[model samples]
Target chain A: MSSALPHLLVLGGARSGKSRFAQGRAEVLTGKLVYLATAQAFDDEMRQRIELHRADRSPRWSTVEAPLDLAEAITAYSTPETVVLVDCLTLWASNLMLAERDTATATEGLARSLSTARGPVILVANEVGLGIVPDNALARRFRDVAGRINQEMAAVVEEAVIMYAGLPLTLKSKG
Target chain B: MSSALPHLLVLGGARSGKSRFAQGRAEVLTGKLVYLATAQAFDDEMRQRIELHRADRSPRWSTVEAPLDLAEAITAYSTPETVVLVDCLTLWASNLMLAERDTATATEGLARSLSTARGPVILVANEVGLGIVPDNALARRFRDVAGRINQEMAAVVEEAVIMYAGLPLTLKSKG
Candidate 1:
């Protein structure tokens, strides 16, 4: 099921406009749009925001919840005639931690899935390791996990970029 | 004491190689290099590490401790024959908060100083806002201050880059 289409990995800090930029990139491509959401609504406000976001992308896209098991979701939802956009791996990494799933193994699986993706797959993630080291062990661990995921995913993707203040800084573009 | 040389802004996360990259950029330019250090050694281990870092840059560079009053330090140290490199603004911001200095006003002063720098000035700062929002109010405030500083510096500098894993991703390069 592997295809030659490029897979993109977009990494950025909070409010860096990574998700919107990624969606715009996905929209410009040919095929049915499939959005793989890895974020979970933890409260009523979050749920409302999520619902509003889904509504915003509703008519032009179909949303698939994959807070966990993202690799499987990518493998199942991607097709030659589809454009799959995964609007974040940071939360997914957290979910893996909470579920006691080994992030290193999961990252390897995700990379493999991306390698065999039948369509153009765009992944968005928060670059959370840039801030000061956290005081808590859990946050520090999460930072390490998230950073490791980004470095690994970035290596696998055909293109990678860091978004800042709504600007794209290309890290790599496989020619 | 303003010169026409373009100042550069280098931003990145921890271990993202921003300082080394900025140093390399500064070393490539013609000048007497001066390093403005903003970090303080609280413990003996940190003292040893700071000493090691200083020794690593010795023979070719002079170091000045500017834990606070960074704008004043830049103004005092910069000259047409010098290339001043501020290893980081993240620590500087923290130092300001610890001392109860007005970060916004200090930032304005820094920007003004950079604009009228007597020679080439290369600023290194952590892109700390890219990660998960900090849980502590103080950490959150620090993140916001650092982010604001970066945004302002990015706009002022003629060259701006985000270093990642020792690689430079150019955000803005003046034409």
Candidate 2:
């Protein structure tokens, strides 16, 4: 139970039930539920996953297809009355890393946007640090970079929830 | 001359006069010029470059260090009385990419910020696509990402400029 609208960061490993847990949390918040989707359907399985997610939502939930410029979408659609749910930051991060691998520019932009979010934000991110070191330079770099981002976001956001075995554990409760 | 303050994007290779050209545009705009810097010195050469830039600024200008969270910094500092000059979006992009390598998240965030600028913005970016493909995966990825970010920015901005040999040429200008 938190007083006032607070930005939330939800962290978990793959299939760790983070997405399921985020939906449960988002349903509790007031105002319209808006999903800021960052994943693009590259293959059939991904496309079906996206569709299933879409089908799971009630008509009240507004879905914004923001593969890029998610902060802007959040700003545009989010109000004090709007609860913004960004599912899975890992995919978003991957999209950016792979898309803009030459220049390290996307993370700062996200930090700037997160700092200025107009309404409550529920962000979903994957924990990528517990695994073994990558064998290659690029993979190794990605892991390191993702780890740093998670650390920074966890530091700034109001609260962070880590999910495992389909259970939610409060990591930090700034709220 | 455009009635609406032209949103300019200045692109150039390293040491190819992109920053200088951007500064010149800022000088022509009405009201105060806001210089948003994104570079942090990691070495002696960088420190020297920073000093040179500092020395080059006019007393009337205001400078702000915004290595991360540029969108938030821009919203906080810029006004209609200001001609917001983002000294180098490439640096900000690079910072974000380096911090997390989450290109989609960062790119989306920046796109949102650029779309809702409070005043005229003169953005500086590097033309990374013109160079040879990087030998390493990270370098190649970075070049690709930088190119996408630049295209995204240029698409929404009112005017676009590319600098060569320290000379500014209007690549996409309205009015």
Which has the greatest DockQ? 1
DockQ for candidate 1, please give it: 0.26
* TM-score on B-chain, cand. 2: 0.91
**Candidate 1 per-residue lDDT over residues A1-175, each given as its tens digit:** 1244589888888888898889888877667999999889999997997887677674779999999899999999989988899978988999999999988999999999998788889999987777667786788778768877887787778888888898998898877
Candidate 2 docking classification: incorrect
Which parts of model 1 are misplaced by more than 4 Å?
A: A1-5, A130-135, A164-167, B1-10, B15-125, B129-160, B164-167, B171-175
TM-score, per-candidate, Cα-based: 0.60, 0.49
DockQ of each: 0.26, 0.01
Q: Report the alpha-carbon TM-score of model 1 versus the true structure.
A: 0.60
Clashing residue pairs for model 1:
A13-B130, A128-B131
Deviation in Å, model 1, residue A66 alpha carbon: 1.4
True contacts kept of 1: 0.42
Candidate 1 local lDDT, B55-132, one digit each (tens): 767467999999998999999999998999997898899889999999999999999998777888989998777556
> By TM-score, who's the top model here?
1
